[model samples]
Structures are given as structure tokens and as C-alpha cells.
Target: MHAALNAAQRTLVREIATLGTESGVGLYIVGGFVRDLLLGGAVREVDLVVEGDAIGFTQTVFSRLGGRVTPHRRFGTAKWRLPRELATACGWTVLDFVMARSESYARPAALPVVKRAAIRDDLLRRDFTINTLAICLDAERAGVTLDFCGGAADLQQRLINVLHPRSFEDDPTRMLRAVRFAERLGCELAPATLQLIEPARAHVAALSGDRLRHELQLVFEEKHSANVLTRLNGFSLLAAIHPALANTADAWLADKLIAAEAAGAAAEVCWLLWLYRLPAAESRLVAQRLRLPVRLTAALQQAQQLGAQRNLGRKLASSEIVSVLAGVQDWALAALVIAAQDEQVRTNLQRYRNDLRYIKPLVTGHVLRARGLAAGPQYAKVLARLRDAWLDGEIHDAAGELALLDRLLLQR
Candidate 1:
């Protein structure tokens, strides 16, 4: 298992082990890093737990390796970002360091109060059994695997099992994580763990909007995001985050997702499609509840409007099509095209995407101004006319554009 790590990861492990030996501090690679390592998956991030001062240990490692270390004194945690060139070479970005700590939630759906504890206690405090596995980086036990919570057995059984019954009550976000991990790892939620999902659903609302948004983003990041959404809906958890999705049907979303995947659409574009059927007011309400950024909300609004007008694209002239889709993003347009039902709408959208959208008159605003055409509201009208002529295939070259301009000037 130790040999599975890449050269960069192995180097990091050796250096941490040496630091532990010199400083007499216990160190181990823990959490997701260990789990992914055991699964023979790519390790893009490293999580480390130190039995002694985590910040001091991080500083020592940084001093030796020449990197920036950011410490959070209050949390007994620190993060080290490798220098850019080295990080590029290593295929990893950051290393997280935390003191071995146990947490106790003050109340249901509240943040935990943390305190330094033994490695065993730390392992027990984790969300899922699979994530509790750890690998020691200290010299004497350099490659020892620690599984105080039957994580290895659970991993072999392909089950996601919580460490305790009250786990979700303490941090409801774990419910979302359970679904994410179950879908991501192609595992099933243990029956006992599945039983708590309903009770945990009620507390998901207590989580802050930012945290909920983050979890939702993680779901969208997955390749099977549509399936994850279906699972969340089945768990009666989707509405707790926002009512818009709860009231709507997900069949169209599933179909659109398949098309979007084939089209190579981005996650944000897929999310916009999911919300495209809602009215602007309802979309705004959902966005506000989820704390979505202003730009994303606006994009959703535009996509909704465009998606509603998809049928009109086929009947409209080329210039009209350009006017309608002038500033819309390609992803948004592609998503709308996928959702469009009419073949002509699809054909027109394809045309716009491939050719018409890029058509513009060879004439420039500078040339128009040089012709003594005042730069004002009328300039836009004239330019629009010129561009429309080009898109309509009526103007083929600069001479044709100049002739059109002369006619417009004569008419003026």
C-alpha cells in the first residue's frame, strides 16, 4: 500500500517521518488521503494529523521545503501550499495539517467544540468509517494502517457506515456527504446509516446557506450528478435547501443532464437547466435561499428566458437570431438547444452556434464615424442594420457594405 503512492507523496511522507523523529511528534496521513490511497485512486490532496503542535510541525516542514504555511491558531490547524513550480511537478497543490482532535457538538445541528485528543479518539470522531482509516508516518511505524472503527472491513463490504447514530444530528451536512460518497464510490449506505437519513433531513435546514451551497456544488461536480439529485430528492432533503426544486419534477432534468453530458456542458450550465422552468421571482427566491452568487443568478435568469423563447428561434430571421443570442454564453445556449423540443429550433440553434453568431459586417465603428456618422443612439441602429445585412447573406464584402452604408446615409 505504501508503494502505491507517487514519488512526490512518498517524499512528503518520508520528510514528515523525519520531522516526527527529530521533534518527537507523532504524525500520520489520515482521512481522505489514506482512504483514496487504499482504494488505489489518485491522491490530489493530502491530509495529515499530528499528535503534537500541528502549526509548529508545518512550519518546520515549510522551512525545509521552502513553501508558504498558513496557520489557524484557534483551530490548531495549518495548510502548506507548495511553491508553484514544485506543485506543478508533484501534481498536488496543498497539504493540510491538523492536530489530533476530538469534537463534541454543543447541540443538534451545531458546530463542534474541538479539543486535542489521542489518534484513536480522532478517528472515532470522523463522519464515516471509511474516512476514519489512517496510515502512520512516524519512523518506527512508518507504514502502519490504523482502523479503530472497522473502516477496512466496511471498505471491503462497499458500505458507507457512520461512526455513531448521532453523527448526522451533530453535522447534518454529512447526510449530503453520505449520498455523495455512496454514489461516487459505487457503494451502498448501510441499513443502519440509511435509517437515520429521515431524522437528519429535518436538520439539513439548520446548516448555513454557504455550507449547503458548497455541498450542492460538490454534488454537481460528480459525473452522476443527476443520480445524486434523485437520491437527495428521494431522501426528502432537496426541498429543505430550497422549495423551487422540491415543487418541480426531475424527469426533464435527468434527460437534459444526459444530453448536456454528451454535449460537454459545464456543471453550472446543467444547474441552470434544472432551474430554467421556474419563474424569475421563484428562481430569485431559490438563489437567495442558497446564497448563489449574483452573476450565477443572472445567468440562470437569462437561460430561463432564452429557454422559454427557444421555439421562436426557428421562425426568426438570421439577424433576429443574432440579436436574441448576442451575449449569451455557449454553455447556456448549448443547454437550451438540448432542452428544445422542435427540430427547427434545434437546427436554428445549431446554425447560430456554428456560423451565424460569428457573422459581422467588415465595417467598423471607426469607419462609420469617419464617414461623419455621429456616434450616438443612431450609430447602434445603423450598425445593427449593417450586421443584419451581413448575417442575411446580402452583403458579401467591404464594397457591398460600403454600398449599403451609402444607401443608409442617403435614406438618412
Candidate 2:
């Protein structure tokens, strides 16, 4: 773990350790950083906990380290953002510092009321045992592991266990988190922990949309997202988020997602594919629940419309293809192209994506004005004709386009 630190990070960590030691404050690295390091997974986030005033600790750190510290006094937490030069050198910017604290929820899915407490109490409030593991960062004890819970045992046993039964009750969002950790860590939820899920299922509805959407985004960013999603569905957590998501056959969407990603489609296209199994109205409802960006919502709708069209064929001229697909967002067309089952349909969509969609008239409104055509709807007609001729291979060169334009003008 010490070797995992880059030179700059090593310097920063050592400085923090020295400062903590001099101040006689207990300091440790907590949460996912310790968990992943112990699991031999690559660690990125650095979460530190202090058994003292975390904001005061930050001021001390800032004086010694010459960096900015953002202290949230209400939460007994601070963010120590490194000086830019050091941050640039290390490729890591901010370190989270928190006072050891305990929490109690007033109601299901309510934000916790936090109180400063001992490290053990702080560990007790964590969602999972594995995440409760901490590593001492004092100068004399820089590598000591602290386990107030049997987190190490659970890690060795490859199990995901809640610290207490009410964990999911307090925050049903952990139900989704449980699936993520289990799938990501290659662990199974302890059977007793699994038993606690059903009763708290309804509380999943009480979670804020941002929290649920953030968790779903993490799932999609996972290397084995499909597996995580399938596991989530098995728990009926998907139904808790939205009935539309639950009704969209898990296996079908999973298969399409796998195929779409295999084609190297962009994330936007992949998202539409996730919404592909739903009816237009249900898709919008799911999008609304997830708070998908306006662009993605629009693309999903356009992709649905494309699904209903049967006229696109390989035999369609490039001009015909553009006419049919015109004004459809490029991302929507890409999703349509990826979803198409027929080779001919895929080919036609691919041509537009790769080549034909970029075809444009050599003659512009400016050129038309110079040619003595009045500035009115006639300009649009002439440009469209020129563009179509180019798209249909009727005008292969700039000279051919101009000649065609001149002849069209004479005919007009």
C-alpha cells in the first residue's frame, strides 16, 4: 500500500502523518480507499478521519502544506485541496477529512443527524463492514489496521454484511449499494443481510432521485454493469425505482446493451438502447425518474420513432435515406443503426452515419443571390435540389453541381 503512493502523494501523506502526530490527534485513512487497497484493487479516493476537530486539522494542514482547505463546520468535515503544482504533479487534487462521528436517522431515507463520536461509533454507522476498515496514519503507526467490526473477517470470507439490521431501513439506498459492492468485489451478500432486504424494499421509493440516479450511473460505469443490473433486478430494487424499468424485460435489455456496447457505440447511444424495450410513454417516464439530460430524453424519443419505421432499405438512394432520416439527431440515428436487425437496414443507416449525412450542396444562398435569384423560399428549393443531386450521385464534382444548378435555373 505504501508503494502505491506516488512520490508527490507519499510526501503529502508523510506530511499529514507528521502533523497528526505532533498535534496528538488520532488520524486514519478510512472508507473505500482502505477497502480497495486491502483487496488489492487500485485506490483513487483518499478519505481521512480525525479523532478531533477536522476543521481545525485542516487549518493546521493548510499552514504546513500551503494549499486550500474547505471546512464544513456543521458536518465536522473538511476538504484539503492540494496546491495546484502538487496536484498537477500527483494527478490527485483533494483529500477528505472528517471528524469521527456517529449518526441516527429520524426516519426512513432521512439524512442522518451526525454527532462527533469515537472511531468505533463512527465505524458502526457505516453501511457495510468492509468499508468500516481503517488504517492508522500516525507517524509511528503509519500502517496499523483498525477494525472495530469484523470487517477483515468478512473480507476474507468474501461476504457483504451490513453492520446492523436497520442499515437498509435507515437508508434503503444501501440496497442498491449492496448490489454494487457485492458484484464489484466478487462477494455475496451474507444470507442474514439478504433477509433484511425485503421488508425495507418500500423505503427505496423514499430515496431522493439524485441518489438513485447516481447509483444507477455508477452501475453503468462498472466493467460488469450488466451483471450488477441483473442482480439489482433479482432483488426487485428496479421495480422500486420505477415500474417502467422493472417491466422492461431484464434479459432483453441486458442482451441489447451487451450488443450495443460491443459495437463501440457511445454512452448516449447505449442509454437509448437501455430505454429501447419500453413503450414511448414508459420510456419518457423512466427518463423522467432518472432525470436524464434533455439531450438523452430527446434521443430516446427519436430512437423509438425510428423503431416504428419500416421504409428504410438498402435499395433507398442516399438522397432518399437522408430525406427519411433528416432532422433526426445523429445520436438518435446511431442508436437506430445499432438497434436495426436487418443487414440492409443497418447498411443504409451506417452509410448515413459514415458518409451520406455529411453531403451538402456546393451552391449556397449567397451563391443563389449572386446568380440573381430573389431571396425567398426559392433559395431553399434550389439548395435542397443541389444537395439531393450530390447525395444521389447525380453530381459527382463541383463543376457538375454548378452545371446542374444553372440548368435547373434555366428550367425554372
Over 4 Å off in model 2, which ranges? 16-26, 50-85, 247-249, 264-268, 360-385, 402-412
User: For this target, which candidate reaches the highest lDDT against the unseen true structure?
Assistant: 2
Write down the lDDT of every candidate, Cα atoms only.
Answer: 0.84, 0.85
Q: Which stretches of candidate 1 lie over 4 Å from their true place?
A: 247-249, 310-313, 369-374, 402-412
Q: Listing every candidate in turn, what is its Cα RMSD in Å to the true structure after a full C-alpha superposition?
A: 2.6, 3.3
- Enumerate residue pairs that collide in model 1: none
Report model 1's TM-score to 2 decimal places: 0.90
Q: lDDT at 406 for candidate 1? A: 96
> CA shift at 339, candidate 1, in angstroms?
1.8
User: Which 10 consecutive positions of candidate 1 have the poorest summed lDDT?
Assistant: 307-316
lDDT of 1 by residue, 1-412 (tens): 5566678766767876898789888898888877877777766467889998899989998888887999998779999998887787777788889999999998878878889988998899999999999888787887899999999888888899999999999999999999999998888999999999887778887888788889988887788788888888888788877767784538888888877777778878777877778888988888888898877777787777877774555677898888888888776677778878887777777888999888877778898899999888988899889999998888888999999999998898
* lDDT at position 85, candidate 1: 77
Per-candidate clashes, comma-separated: 0, 0
